[model samples]
Target: MSPALHRRLPLLATAAVLVGLYASGGLLYDGFLSGRVALNLLADNAALGLTAVGLTLVIFSGGIDLSVGAVVGFTSIFTATLVERHGVHPALAAAAALAVGGALGAGMGALIHWFRQPPFLITLAGMFLMRGGAYWISTESVGLTHPLYNRLAAYELPLGGRLGLPVTSLVLLAALALGGIIAHYTRFGRNLLALGGSESSALLMGVPLAGTRIAVYALSSLAATVAGLVLALYTGSGNPTFGLGLELDAIAVVVIGGTLLRGGRGHLLGTLLGLLVFGVIQTALTFDGRLSAQWGRIIVGALLLAFILVQRLLHERLGRRRDPIHTV
Candidate 1:
């Protein structure tokens, strides 16, 4: 296989799994192949998709952000508290949430880069801090009864013939498109890829390491905040505990989407397919009355493990090929 095709093997595998899962669901469940079902898949996984999109960028730079899920939780609760208790407009509250998320991300990035700290440790601290902040804001779920919230929640764009796209789903698709463009067409994206591929090489090539590192984390946080906003609107409430353990799910989707866990390779579109694969499995389990939530998690865990093994094999094989004589 050509190098390009070889690199895309994981992405192709992800797409294949998605199609196979959906086909199996259609065969096993009534009305599973309908347009409505297809749209519902997007709607249900919108927040997750958004999170995965941001996480994909981070992974592309060979970094991880454990704080993503906590940031989502924090943003949801913080926005809710502002709107419901402080009589703040939902829009303004959301802006505040986004700003806070960005700041948190930047801070973590600074620590990781300037202090030469491990991304994992820094982001883990961020995770704890954000989660605690959410609890501080409110220990319970905050319900949104605002008129604007209700209107936005009910609004859906008509897609022909009884098909419609929810606002959250639309945002997700738009974000995905923007992310793709940024990843492929911009200097920052190139720097990010180079940084992930080899930080020393990137530095030698004169890439703006500090700015790129900080910006990627901040961008990831912004995405998490957006996911929180979407989740708040989708659920009609913002729970302080929302998105608990979701960072792992987002990471899993990014990895399953073919982005190397070690950094330096991946596509945003692949993450979308991985998200769909996850949604399909969960939805299918729900369709099966006999199956439990534990089974859904177990299946996803198994798939994630399988993909990790594949990635490891490919990484080693490709590494040797690239450095035939020096590789030992």
Candidate 2:
């Protein structure tokens, strides 16, 4: 296999599954076989894809972030609440959400750096805090009726005729492009990979280790905030509990995209492929309505486990350094 194809082996397999689903979609619902479904697929994957992009960076830096689901939850709820209760401008509300998300990320980064606690524990605490905070903001789900939010959320640019690209999707794609540039061209990007590879050595080599890791988390939060806003707009409502299991999905997408879960290795293209696979699976599952969404989770978990096992076996065969965490 060529380098690019080898790198995206998992995604390529997922694409085959997507084609299978599309074929199966015809048998279940003729509507699902339409171009509309394809449009919806892109729309549905946009927010998840954006969040996964940010997460790919954090994972690449050798850290796990559990607070992302909560952060997206919090930001979504906050956006809707502010529009309904305070009449905040959509632009200003968006800015506030991003700033708060960044602050939360910075806090978690500080905790990990200063206390020497594993990120798992710190972000777990963050998850609860943000989830509860979402409830505190609104005990009930809220939908947007504001003229501004409605206009912005539903706005579409003419891509051709009946087919059009949504403003939300366009903005999300723009964010993805910006993230790709940051990941490949910047000093911060190099530092993130170097730090994950060997923090001690990276520091000794003057890679600005602390700042890079801290910023990576912050960027993750910022991306989550952006997704949250788009979600509120598209759904015309906020579900504080909506992203309950999304962090796992994001992590799975990162890994499936060809990014290593253990960190120090990953790319944006891998994440994009991962999102495509996830979208295809969900689309296929929806076509078979008799199957529960719960089954989707089970399948996702199985896939994650299988990929992890493959990595471990590869490492063993290569005689690379073994991880102490999962050896037993």
| Alpha carbon lDDT of each predicted model | 0.91, 0.79
lDDT of 1 by residue, 1-55 (tens): 9999888888998999899999999999998889998899889988889989888
lDDT of 2 by residue, 24-140 (tens): 666767577776677777688777877888888888788989888888889889988887889898788889899999999988888888788898998899889989999999878
Clashing pairs in 1: 62-263
Per-candidate alpha-carbon RMSD to the true structure: 1.1, 3.3
Residue 186 lDDT (model 2): 89
**TM-score of model number 1:** 0.98
**Candidate 1 deviant stretches above 4 angstroms:** none
Which candidate should be chosen as best, given lDDT against the real structure? 1
Tell me the lDDT of model 2 at 26.
Answer: 68
Task: Please give each candidate's TM-score.
Answer: 0.98, 0.88
